[model samples]
Target: MKKIIVLCVAALSLPIAIAQEKITLTQAECRQMALAHSEDLQKADNAVMQAELDKDIAFAAYLPKLDATATGTYMFPDMDMMGAKLQMRGMYLAGISLTQPIYAGGQIRAGNRLSEIGKDCALENQRKARMQVIADADNAYWTYIAVLWKVRMLESYKAQMDTLFRQTESGVSAGMATENDLLRITAKKSEIHYQLQKAENGANLCRLALCNVLGCDLDTSIEPTDTVIKVSLPAELDTDISMRPELRLLHKQVEAAEQQVKMSRAEVLPTIGLSAGYMYFGNIKMKSEVGGQSFTQKIEDGNALVSVLVNIPLFHWGEGTQKIKKARLDLQNAQLDLQKNTR
Candidate 1:
């Protein structure tokens, strides 16, 4: 029975030991884990991919478009006109048309340019997100390590106080120390104990925060590989801010606004297109009887035609002009924003 009880206690303790297993990780590893776990970075990547697809879609506007059409009709009754009967049974028509844009007033080009700028903006956003995640990971990692050190320091201090309390008790028994001294040491030890408990709780909270950043189990103990930090000063300071992702994104936005202005201007300009189609028709017939002689006439053939189309926006109550002005204003706003951020 004792052996059974011992076996059951060991079985219960096994999972607890496994659950508290320490995981040792370096700062770099923690940052990498955080990067992998960051939803913002993933969203940034998706935005970049969507931008690329938009660029492709914009470029497709420059290519020719093809369309197919088919039609069929049937008549249920014949018609009589002046003693002559006209019979119609079935009619069918099929055609395929190709339309190519000769000119679109620079709208397609400007749209493509805008999509490219959008892609660049998404890339900059991704870079910014990556940097942010890494910074957060580093902060959490170092903060947890610091708190762990604090906990250890408090434990050590508690041990030293305990030793002092014992010595004081012995001295009081030997009459070398007063009871007041022992009481003073006991109160101090109690304070130290309270402080140690608080530090341990703080350390646990910090550990949980680091685990959250790392996307790991909170119950898993973490031991940082770095115990001491090495501080260094840069030999030279670099003040260039143009390469920053935020600044680059702003620049891209400005370029995109310029493209929007161009696109708006294009709305008022003339557009030209070329279209070609081939049509086939069959199963159409007219039956007629004259002088007791019957005859049937059927029309079944195929024909092709090409045409050029031109459009000029004469007027729309100054709508196009207003749009152009609005786009220009937006462009100005973007420029102002860029200037403000740069300053």
Candidate 2:
């Protein structure tokens, strides 16, 4: 019975002990947690992955493509022609073809370049997302620390007020202080109490905010183990904006737009391709009679062929030129946007 009671008591106390435990986190740790918790950052990473796949798909245009086909046909009845029966009992064909583009009027190259630019833009966007997350985390961490320090300062001041009130009470008992003075001290102490409570409430709210930023449970207690440090200004400040991710992303956009113009221009140009194929057919029979003689001929054969294909755009009512003009306009717009954002 005693052992069972001890076990029950220990079990009851475990939760209380766990609830009282505080998690100590540093500024760097908080930033790391916030980065891991950021959903936007994760989506940015996914975009980068998708961009890589797009790049690969664009590059595949430069490689050869292989395809296969099979077909079968069966005739239920024979046809009579020229005083004879013609029979095609069953026909089967199998073929495989390989095609490689020799030239595509620079469209394939431009598409690949556009894909590369998209990949670069995705990377830059991811970098920007990381920077934003870190900045938010740092801001939340510093604000929480400031509120905690304010609460500590208010508590210390309240202690000093308490000591003063006690001294004033002692003086009043010895007739050195009046009842009015005692009442004033009492009022001041009450004010200190109210201020302290308010400060504590503010600290709790700040802690909750910090927890939200860190993506942790609201009920979990956190202790920031870092202190605000003094800072000194550098002798000289460098003003350089070229390395910012936002600018890089815009730069990629401009490049992509330029590639789009190239691809549009390619629409009016000629394309060249090479193809090789081999086909096999079997089980085809033709029956006929000539000069009072009947005979059956079975046709089973295979053939291979290689050929070069060329296609040129002839006339489309000025559509190709209009598309190229539109693409050029889009490129110009992209350039203008980049220039505006850079300034």
Candidate 3:
């Protein structure tokens, strides 16, 4: 019977030990995992990737474009000379062409510049998301630690009150203290219990928030191996506004807008294009009749050509003027935003 009791006790202890062997996460480890797994960060990174793709697309416009084309045709009831009947003709042709843009009225340049600005903005937005995640994690970690400390303090207070209640009971029994004293201590103990409950709830909530930021299961247990360190802020501000990502992004926007204005003005100027192509024509048909003898022949010919195209915009109603005005206003607004963010 004693052996059976010992075996049961050992079985219970085995499960408890297994439960305690689960993995625990340190604060730094949690932060690193959050940086890699957080949904918000991933979205920000995707935005940056999209911006880069846009930049690539915009830059591609400056390069030459190549294309190939083919055509087939069939004709019935072919026309004849001197009111005589002729045979029908069928033909097939194929060609390749290339066009290079030497100039585009600054449109390509402005587009590339805008893409660069967009990329910068996307990067800054990513930085902001990262900072927000770090701040949130910090707040959650500190709050959790604070609540845990509060729980410990409440437990300590409860233990002292328990001892006091026992002493008061003993005193009352010996006719040295009144029952009211014991009742007061009991009331205090009840209040501490309520506080402990509240503290536990707060700690649980903090853990949930931390888990959410870390992109982990809500029920997963987290044990912060690192202790929270408190630091006092400096009395005087030493950080400069120019170093802030917000300010830098705004400045880049202003510069991009200025470039846009310049590009818009360039639209009024002439554009030049250098185009060259090699084309092949196959299966050409020609009708011929000599001494009442008719025949068909297949031929192929290749040709290379180079040309230059120049475009001068004399007038476009008020579209160009409107664009220039819009660009100027955008530059002004970007400047104002930069100023505001700096402040």
User: Best candidate, lDDT-wise?
Assistant: 1
TM-scores of all models?
Answer: 0.90, 0.87, 0.84
Poorly placed runs, candidate 3 (over 4 Å): 1-23, 79-90, 228-237, 266-268, 295-299
Candidate 1 lands at a TM-score of 0.90
lDDT (0 to 1) per candidate: 0.91, 0.90, 0.81
Local error of candidate 2 at residue 319 (angstroms): 3.8
Q: Which sections of candidate 1 miss by over 4 Å? A: 1-18, 75-90
How do the residues 79-179 of candidate 3 rate in per-residue lDDT, one tens digit apiece?
56554444335556666777888878788898898899889889998998898787777777777777878888988988888888888999999999998
Residue-by-residue lDDT tens digits, candidate 1, 71-144: 98877687775665555577889999999999989999999999988988999999999999999998898998
What TM-score does prediction 3 earn? 0.84
Q: Which wins on lDDT, candidate 1 or candidate 2?
A: 1
lDDT, residue 302, candidate 1? 99
Give per-candidate clash totals. 0, 0, 0
* Residue 236, candidate 3: alpha-carbon lDDT: 100
Per-residue lDDT of 203 in model 3: 85
Better of 1 and 3 by TM-score: 1
Better of 1 and 2 by TM-score: 1
